[model samples]
Target: MKYNNQRPVVIGVTGGSGSGKTTVSRKIFNELSQNSILILQQDSYYNDQANMTMEQRANVNYDHPLAFDTDLLIEQLSQLLDYKAIEKPVYDYNLLTRGTETIHQEPREVIILEGILILDDARLRDLMDIKVFVDTDDDIRIIRRIQRDTQERGRSLDGIIEQYLNTVKPMYHQFVEPTKRYADIIVPEGGNNQVAIDLLTTKIRSILMQRGNDKIINNKDSTI
Candidate 1:
């Protein structure tokens, strides 16, 4: 995975809901940032669901591919790939909208994009140098989702169950499940899979070394 100086490597990490994709992304980001890597989350590109009334939003399936502003994300990613400067959008979960905070990201030697639907869009899939899918069992995923929504997302048990049965499970079967075929690697058991995580870390290190970036530490200057 040695990257040319002129090109930026894009790594995509995707999985179904409650698959611990975020946790995997964080681990990879930490490992790669040792070589001056920058990470982005596709969750930041979720379309403004807050603006719509509860009725409108209620009918909306947040897990659907159409819920994200893929075009805008692609445009920004394009600029980054071309080594141009761009402002990345900041998404607010509480407001459920795109926020005012804009992060300026310059070209990095490596970029990691993590989300549940990163592989769903063809354009996004084309941009990835490496793509990974984290898989968890359906029942386990549902339980995890219930815990997360109830504790972190301020959702009731009944509401969480309703959403899971009504929207999440169906969407997983329709959209997320099919995209696993596109992954270069599939990680099972989520974060508990230490062997897979170690292998990934080793691969990332080897690639950075080949790129002559082994010494690129994440200091203030490197990020700039």
Candidate 2:
């Protein structure tokens, strides 16, 4: 059985834009016991766009580490580690702005924080019990980005290419790629690699079971 009161195992899933970090996160989430895991997106903690005009927001280099509200993310994760719930912000992809409402997240045994630049900060790195980076070809990632932005976010193909050229590619090399050295696991081909996913699932289960067993032993010992 899963331990409800056990402290969460914070897992940081990071990769370049369209590198399939989200897919990998979802696969891991699916494998974990139901109600025992929660997935948090770095996209949700984007710096609010209220101060800037839509034109300004359009020009913003979102792929950079500076674009994320890392301070707030740190605080939220700290709360999760303490077994406290959080009101996570929600971002609107179409408007490139933070939404008026928030998402209520309960503490769980596994907290999966998925994003592009998550590993770019040292403090954030310190909080992760496990860090995973999804590695994919640049061509494939750009194609995925183009398709998603155009189809889902109502962005034009030209606009996607412009932003990818001006911001995404450069930021990936500078901020995203360097962080790969910090990852505990590097998943190639993203979520389609069943071997990697299976190995990761096993590792997570082992960690969870070990922690659960330790808690039970401690409780019995304390009563004696």
Tell me the TM-score of each prediction against the true structure: 0.88, 0.91
Question: How much is 142 displaced in model 1, in angstroms?
Answer: 1.3
- Model 2 alpha-carbon miss at residue 76, Å: 0.6
| Candidate 1 segments whose C-alpha is farther than 4 A from its true place | 1-4, 49-51, 215-224
Model 1 earns a TM-score of 0.88
| Error in Å for residue 21 of model 1 | 1.0
Write model 2 residue lDDT over 1-224, tens digit each, in one string.
33456577888999998999989999888876443677888989999989899999988888888789999999999997887879999998778889999988766767788999889899999989899999999999999999898778888899889889898999999889999999999999998988998998778777877776343322211100
RMSD of each: 3.1, 5.5
Superposed by TM-score, candidate 1 places the C-alpha of residue 6 at a distance from the truth, in angstroms, of: 3.2
